[model samples]
Target chain A: MSIDAIHPDWVAVDWGTTHVRVWLMSHDGRVLDHRRSDQGMGRLDQDQFEPVLTDLLAGVPPSQSLPVLICGMAGSRQGWTEAPYVATPCSPPGIGQATRARCKTWDVRILPGVKQASPADVMRGEETQIAGVLLEEPTFSGVLCLPGTHNKWVRIVKGRIVSFQTFMTGELFALLEGQSVLRHSVATRGWDADAFDIGVSQGLDQPHALAGALFSLRAESLLNDLSGTAARARLSGLLIGAELAATRPLWRDHKVAVLGGNDVAQSYEAALAAQGAVLHALDIDTPTLSGLRAAYAHLKETT
Target chain B: MSIDAIHPDWVAVDWGTTHVRVWLMSHDGRVLDHRRSDQGMGRLDQDQFEPVLTDLLAGVPPSQSLPVLICGMAGSRQGWTEAPYVATPCSPPGIGQATRARCKTWDVRILPGVKQASPADVMRGEETQIAGVLLEEPTFSGVLCLPGTHNKWVRIVKGRIVSFQTFMTGELFALLEGQSVLRHSVATRGWDADAFDIGVSQGLDQPHALAGALFSLRAESLLNDLSGTAARARLSGLLIGAELAATRPLWRDHKVAVLGGNDVAQSYEAALAAQGAVLHALDIDTPTLSGLRAAYAHLKETT
Candidate 1:
C-alpha cells in the first residue's frame, strides 16, 4: 500500500521493565502525539499486558487505529509474548515478528529483538533504536554502543546490524555498591575522577585482573582510608576496565558511536577517549523513536 | 616460652561464618583432638562470641591450656571483634594482630589479613595461606592465586607478600548463571573447553570490550541455539578471559601458583595455561593450616 492510501495512525511502544512509552504518528509517519505510563512491563504479570495497553490507548478514535509495533523486554519469554530472536550480523530488515496480537479494531505486532554470535549477546528494544539509526544515517558504519543497565555494542555494516555484544556493567555496579559487603566500606559521596582514570588505565592495561582490583576498593577504605567517592569511582573504573578489555577487540579499528542515557553515554565516551578512539554520541530516545518508526514503515511496506 | 616448656593440650580454632572448627592441639601444635560445631560467628550477636567460645571449650583440661589462634570471617566487623588490616608488601614478620580475647588461662589472638593499593583490594585469611606456602616452600617466589568466592592473585618475593589482587570471578559466575537474566539461557552442565578458550582469547585480544562481550552469551543462545553447556562455557570464558586480561600484566615474568578448591583451581590453571604461563596448583586446605602454623610459630618465636 502507498503511504497515502491508508488513513492509519502509527503507534510505537517501548515497553521495558520499569516504564511503558507509546508514540502516536500520522499516516505519513510523523509523530502526532505521545504518552507514557509508569506501568512498565517489568512490574506486571503476562496477563495484565493487554488491559494496560488498552487503558493506555483509551482515548484514541477507532477509525484512526494503527498497527502498533512494540519492543524491549515485553517480548521475552517472561514478557507478554515471546518474540523470536533474529540472528547476528542481521538488521531490522531481518528481525522476526511477534505473531500479531489482534485488538478488536487494530492489528498489533511486536518487533523481535536482535541476537548475534561472535561475542554472543542479545538486545530487545535497542535493536529497534539501531534500526532507526540505520534509517536516519543509512551510510553510517562501524560500532554503535548503547550503554545502560545492559550496555550493548553493535557492529553495523551497510546498514545491517551484522553483530553485537552486551555488558552487565551497570547491573554489577549497582549490586556491588548497594547489595554486597563492600557497601559497608564505601561512602555515598566523593567520586574521584583520577581514581576512575586509574581504573580505566588498569582495566585497559590488565583486564584479567579487573575482578581482583574490585577488592582493592574495600582495602583502600580500610587500609588507606580512601573517601567513599574514590571507592565508587574505583568500582566504576573496575567495571569500565573489564568492559574495555572485552570490547577493545571488536571496535579496535572501527569508529565508535555511543547511544544511551546521558551519564552512561558520557562514561563510555570518556572510556573511548582514553583509548584515543573516534566516537559519536546519539540520543537514546530519538533513535528509539526512529527505530520504532522504521519498524512501522517496514511493516507497512511488507503488508 | 620454649616449645618443650609449654603445656601439652591447647585449642586451634578456625572460626568462620556458618561453621566453627576446633582442633585440640598439643603444645607443639599437633592435632591431638578435633571437633566442629555449627555455632559459627556469623550466626551470633557480637556480645555472644565469648560465651560461644567458652561453651565450646567447656570440657578441655585446664592443665593443657594453650594459646588459641582464630581466623576467617570471625575477625570481621560483624564477627567477634574487628581484626585490623595489615598493609601490602607485608612479610611474615610484618603481620598485624587482632585485639586479644582472654578466657581464664587460654589466650586468643586473631590473625590479621593483608591489603594492597593501586586497585585497592583486601584479604584476611589468604595471606596466612601465603605465609603457609612460605613456611612449606620458603625459597619459592612468584604469583600465588587463592581462588574462591573472592579469588586472590598474590605476589610474593622471598618469603613476604609484596602485593596482591582479588577477583570476584566465582561470585560473578554464580550470580550470572543462577540469578541474572542470562540464567535461563544457559545449561546446568556440559562444559566446553574450546568455547571457553575462545572467550578467553577474545577477552585477551579485546580487554577493553569485556563488558560488551558478556551480553553475547544470551544473544548467542537466542540466535544460534547454543547448547546450555556451551553457553555456560562461553560465560566462563568471558569472565575468565576478562580476569586474564586484568591479571596477565602482574604475572608476566613470574611463575604462577593457584590455591583453591579443586575444580576452580583447575579452571584458573586452564586459563593460565592457555595464556602460556607456568602454573602450580596447591591444595587450599593444607596451605591454610600451614599458614596458621606459620603464624603461630612466628608469634611463639617473637614473644
Candidate 2:
C-alpha cells in the first residue's frame, strides 16, 4: 500500500527513561508508520505526557479515535498514568489489567510492570517484552536473559514469571569505562575478542578479586602499555562474566532464550555459550511488538 | 618555643592528588609549624607546583638554601619532579633515591614511590607512610592495610615491601553511593553497625553474588521502605567485604597493621576484625611524619 493509503488500527509504544518509540500498526499487525522522540517519561512531567504524545502523532491523518497501547516506564508512578505492578508468579499483565490514560483523541492502555516481594525486584517495559515472548510460544518454559543497562535473568515456567534477578553489570561497565580511573586505560571505541575472553575467564573464575582486577587495568596501562581497546573489551567481559557468575543458577543447566540482537546481548550469548548454555537468539523487536499485540487483543476482547 | 622563636631545620611535604601538607621540622624531629592547601599535584601543572608551594611557604621565614623533602604524587611523572618508582622486594624509597626539582631557592627532594612489576601495582604517598612505619619498628614484618581512595594491601618483610595489591574498594564505594542508581536509596549520613556486619558477611560468604546484592539494595528501598542509613552502611560493608574476600591472602593468618584514624580506615579495621584479622590501629599521621623524618635523616647523611 502507498504511504497515504492506509490508516493505523492501533499505536504500539515502547516508552522508557530516555526515549520513546511508536509503531503505527495495521489491523493485521503490519507496521504502517514508525515514529520516535526523545521526549520519554523521564523528561516529561505528569501533565506533559499527553501533549507530547499528541504532538508526535500530529503527522498521522485523522482516524476515528485510534487505540494507543503503551508499555514501559510511561506506566510508572512518574509516568503519564501509573499502572501498578503485578506481583510475580503471575502472567505479565494483559489488557484486562492495563490502566487507561486520559487523552482527547485516543483510547490509551498502559501495561503494568512486574514486582517481586522478597529479595525485592521489579521490571517495567521488559514485562511487555516477556508477554510478547509468551505470545509466540505460550507453552514454552525456559529462562530469558534480557541484556540491557540493568541485565535481567528471568525464569519462566509455562508462561508465568517464576522469579528474576538483576545485575548491575552493564551500568558498572559504563561507569568504569567512562568515569572511573580506568577510563584513561579503556578506549571509547574498539574490539579485542581475546582480551574479552581472558577477562570473562578471570571474572568467572576469580570473581572475588574483581576490585583488585579493576585496578590492574589502570596498572597495566601505566606499567605495560595495555591498549585502550583491549582494556575496554576486558572491562566489558569482566562485568558480564561476573554477572554470569552471580546468576549461574538461572541458566547453568537450563535452555535459555537470549533476547535482543545488540552487542551486549551477543556478548552475553557468547559468554553463555562458553559456559555450555543451550541457547537461542531472539530478535529484540519480536517480543515487544508481539507483547503489545497480545495486549491489544486482550483490550479488544475485554472491552 | 614561640612560633617566631624557632626556625625549621628542614621542611617535610606530603603532596597527594587532592591536597598538599607541609610541616616545618626542627633539628630534633619536632613539627615547628604545619600548613595545608588544596593545591595538590592533581590540581596543578608542572610549573604551578613550585608557585603554589612558594605561596604557601610565604609565611615561613626563608633561610639560606632550606632543604625540602617531598613525597606522594608530587614526584609523579606529572608532578613537580618525576621521581621514578623503586621496584618491590626493596625498602621504601629513601632520600638516597630522591629526585631533585629545579626550584629557585629551596633544595627540593621528592622521594620515589614503590612498584610491583608482576601484578602491576604502584603506590606513591603511602610509601612515605610505610617508611615511617618501618622507622619505628625497623625489623617489623607483617601486612599493612592502607585505606584511602584506593585502598592498598602491602606485605612488608624485614623492612622491605615484598609485594602489594591495590583495590578500588573506596573508589567503587564512592561511585556507587554518590553516582550510581543506588544513590537514590543510600543516605549520605547515618550508621547501622548491624546492617554493615550483615553486608560484610554476605559479601564475604557469597562474593560472587555482589552484582545482584547491589541491585537488591535499591529493590529493598523501593519495595520494603529500607532505611537510607542502613542501605548506606550495607553498601560500604559489601564493597569492603568484597575487597576482603579478594585480598584474603594478604590479611588472613598474618598480623595486619591497619593505618589511618579516619572512618575509612576504621571501617576496614572493623571489617577485618570481623574476619578475625589480627590488627593494630596506628595514628594516621604517625607513618607519614615518621617516613618523612626517616627520609630527612637520610638526606642529612647524604648531602
Give lDDT per model, in order. Answer: 0.73, 0.86
Model no. 2, DockQ: 0.73
Question: Which candidate gets the maximum DockQ versus the true structure?
Answer: 2
lDDT of 1 by residue, A193-264 (tens): 788888788777766666666666766777778788888887888788778766776657898898866776
DockQ, all candidates in order: 0.44, 0.73
TM-score, cand. 1 vs. native: 0.81
Point to the candidate with the largest TM-score: 2
Give each candidate's fraction of reference contacts reproduced: 0.82, 0.80
Which regions in candidate 2 have their CA more than 4 angstroms from the true location?
A1-7, A61-65, A102-106, A283-286, B1-7, B61-64
Which pairs in model 2 have colliding backbones? A132-A291, B132-B291
For this target, which candidate reaches the highest lDDT against the unseen true structure?
A: 2
